[model samples]
Target: MQECSPPAQVAGRTPEKALLSPSRARYGEGMSRIDRPALGILLICAGVTAISVNDFQIKLLSGGYPLHQIVFIRSAIGLALTLVLLRFEGGFAALRTATPGLHLLRGLFVVAANMTFYAAVAVLPLAQATALFFVAPLFITLLSIPFLGERVGPVRLFAVVAGFAGVLLMQVPEAEGAGTVSPGVLLLPVAAAFLYASMQVLTRKLGAQASAAALAIYIQTTFLIVSALFFLVAGDGRFAEHTTNDSLRFLLRAWHWPTPEDWPLFLGIGAVAGVIGYCLSAAYRLANASIIAPFEYLGLPLAILWGWLVFGEWPSVLTWAGSALIVGAGLVVFFREGARPRPNRAARR
Candidate 1:
């Protein structure tokens, strides 16, 4: 499936739930097999780790390189890896989309969402930025109603309300909290969450034409084009001297030639992006979303650990309180949805 909507991390869903065709709800995807669920958990654990490391390195490199430059290099490598992985799904033909316009629109929304979230990451503590971003589950829960014609029961409705309260709680951290960013800047992650959730909803309109690898290829291509455009317009770094804001600086700063020492980080994240997408794509296909969804919450703790280890940042009391609410609400929803009965692969076809 999609990366929690690429390996970026989702608020409340397994990557499979977010990216799978809206018409197909395989709550029991691989349940017939005993080993499958364990494998899925292991794959998600690996995926979360890759995403954490990737995010840490991106934040590390932000001070030295423009966001678009890093995106360009990362996407360039990831695109190649996705192309090779396409073989498993049915080759390049899987990319054939009857709804090109929908694909284009989705790719652009994903690009915008990533830009804002990373912008937040460059300035805020990784744990705080990620915790706030997990609000996407709230957004998706609401969006699915009108968009996918799905009904939200009173239980899920209550969960959405609580998850939203979590967002409000995080808005005012303790005085000693290190996760604080400018109030205006804090909105970036929320905005990204909205866009990411909206992208998932919009995908329902796309029909079941493209495979996960093919969809990833479209997104990487979008990243490549958008980053290239950023370079052509601002590679000179002339515009960067105007601001001292780290997030702005990260976004508009001039590109630089890669140093030998940093080359490995740049190349390595891209490779990891490819493998994460390919392997997790299969992992979800072989597992159930309900069982997998709770584990996906591991991303939050992983974010907290990375923030502490790499940047010496710690979550405030409010951050913890808010995360608990959001995560708890998401689990309720996932468990309920998972318990619902559904037909097997034959019925889906």
Candidate 2:
């Protein structure tokens, strides 16, 4: 667990220092043993909180706007922000790729992941949706074996199993209270998690040829376009008489646009979410996937808190216990990975 020095990515750079701070650059020296990881964890926590608030807002907004409409708005804003950040690196040309096939598939997966997960959120509690999405780590663990050609140890396998068991624990209580959970509804997060895991793997492959920011911009732009199209079609009666079954309708019908009075909340979401995305990209650049992967569980507690405070949706005691186990399993995997040797410097970035 020796701290390595930050690579040339930050060397002699003023903006880098201002953005990540000098202490962050010193993460490699192991001098400040606790700082880097703590920061990484804190960033993860903040990212999750921002994301939960975003989800909650989307949920409330769903009642007023169509899911596609809301996604279109958010993605449009997100993509605009991403493009502005990418201007320094390169413009749209920087995001161009030789692998158009992968880009197409990646976009499809990204949109599908959003649609499915949002649909799930429209039906299930925020905590439940968040808990089920935890399966993405397990999916990542398994996918890495064949895709990344990484070996999966028995302990990691056990962690994955324990994670799934936690999922069952969360679900069983809901089933008992509200009859059987439909496979379609319950499995949306599972499918989205798997798709997201696949997206992560794809990003690793794409990471070498293209900058992460460029890739992110491309994906968000893709989603924005697709979402706009879907929203238009839905509004035009492409689906079943534009029923409320679609996610976009759920949001649009729920809440009116936040006026000047609600600008604080809107700005809070935009600023926090924009920064979270930036921090997550920076973290992925600084460290290996394993080191940052487990920290994603920080979202669970944040989601639970937000759910209770805003929506008054208290999770059952059983869910609380299950969430604990899942978090524990994620931590075990994260800590185990941290203890292992990191790849060489040249290969990490």
RMSD of each: 4.7, 7.9
Clashes of 2: 22
lDDT of each: 0.71, 0.58
The CA lDDT at 240 in model 2 is 40
Find the number of clashing residue pairs for candidate 1: 1
Residues 62-151 of candidate 1: C-alpha lDDT, one tens digit per residue:
889999999999888988988987887777767776578887887788889888989988988888778777777677778878876667
Per-residue alpha-carbon lDDT of candidate 2 for residues 118-214, written as tens digits (9 for 90 to 100): 7778777778777777676567667767876667788978988898888777667353222344556767777877787777666554432344456
Off by over 4 Å in 1: 1-39, 173-180, 341-349
| Candidate 2 TM-score over all chains jointly | 0.76
Best by TM-score: 1
